[model samples]
Target: MQNPAAATSASEFAELPATASHGPLRIEYRWVNETACDAPIAVFLHEGLGSISMWRDWPQALCERLGMRGLVYSRPGYGLSTPRPHDVKWPVDFMTAQARDILPALLDALDIDLPERRSMWLIGHSDGGSITLLYAALHPDALAGAVAIAPHVFVEDISVESIAQTKQLYETTDLRAKLGRYHADVDSAFYGWNDIWLNPAFRDWTITSELAPIRVPLLAVQGHDDNYGTMAQIDTIADCVPHAELVKLDGCGHSPHRDAPQALNEAIAAFVSKQK
Candidate 1:
């Protein structure tokens, strides 16, 4: 792996054309350790309410430590990317749509050949983590490994309750102002995620059965004190994927990357190194 002291460049944007399922969108992305193109590539997927900027320097820091190239991007409705249409309400299978449609489209636009090049991995957090699992399961041959932090395999009552509280906070607190710094259209980004997760019909969401198809190594990380989800999230991954590994961190919440960057980085680096 490469040392974290290596030089890197600033973040940039790329325009992805419209696909049958998704409209044209601009993606804000950053390349870490660009000089090390020959090394493996790791894609960082942000959480339900996260954006590329919200990840701060962690993605670059982790990529530099692993001596690998990293791709960190905000999904269509987040960060500097395009906003979701006002009339559109995200479907129940929103994450599935991301994994099966948007993600592949974004990668194709970026010219990342997954089928021909197998040295790629996905590091996703929260909703992003679930997307990673779905993608990895659907395209088992395209990736080498995956790391999911605070991912939900099934919706829990706590998850819905916490989301409800967040909705209240967004309305009552400065949370909207704080989130505006990260998203281009805060309402689009927030409602697209919040509405679906808290939807009455979405409470039945579960991806455990879909996980059985994953063939690559997986590292599932969760915080013991996570208010949004419990250890059962990663436990489900381990139960479905025989080669899956779990890391439970204490004194941490839903966002492990933010709550425990040092430990999370080390765990991810070690896991990727072992896979290599």
Candidate 2:
């Protein structure tokens, strides 16, 4: 895999030298299969602690399989994008703001045309998956289809416990050094997500009611073995959106794209084909 924002590649860094504006934040993004303009556009949203490099090549593989162009980007405070201010804590509504504000602005900055947006499909994982649900709910007309992999609609005890444990791993182990390969400011990426989830006030966070407005073709997917959350996350999604379909993968952990790529890709391709 090409080192994503790794220390080794000055040429790779040069390729993504420009930044897009999402208000005060400078966002870094990369295009996959840009030449395939005839196909629909697939925009990938990474997990809470993820960046563009963390996604590796799954975006390309899935986009090729579905005959779509892909957009993969690092969120502000992650990857080569603008780092979050050390003193600032992400608000509970941060994911909502991403769906409502930052994503739209990034698309605008990229100058993706309306025709592309009209034929857009969003594929998001973990925290990004929740953001996808929010985007579809808020802008029902904006998407052709959406696939949310391992999304959290509401905070759970297991989720908190896992995140807290991850904090310990980050502090006491080489997790930070490992993640440093993908992000310019690993702490900005890690703490922005960690601080908020572990906050006592954030325990009450849930988008269950907000999910009712999602009118786009939707798929809620999760691995049966996901340690961070239970199947109830997607189960709750199905309850809110009557039309939403669910996929539960066995022998898979949190990262389905890596753990069960063929299964996830096939499910997504089949789901998108029906959209046409």
- Quickly count the clashes in candidate 1: 1
- TM-score per model over all chains: 0.94, 0.92
* Tens digits of per-residue lDDT for model 2, 197-226: 999999999999999989899999999999
Q: Tens digit of lDDT per residue, candidate 1, span 127-188?
A: 99999999999988889889999998999999999999999999999999999999989999
Please report how far candidate 2 places residue 76 from its true position, in Å.
0.6
Winning model by lDDT:
1
RMSD after CA superposition, every candidate: 2.9, 4.7
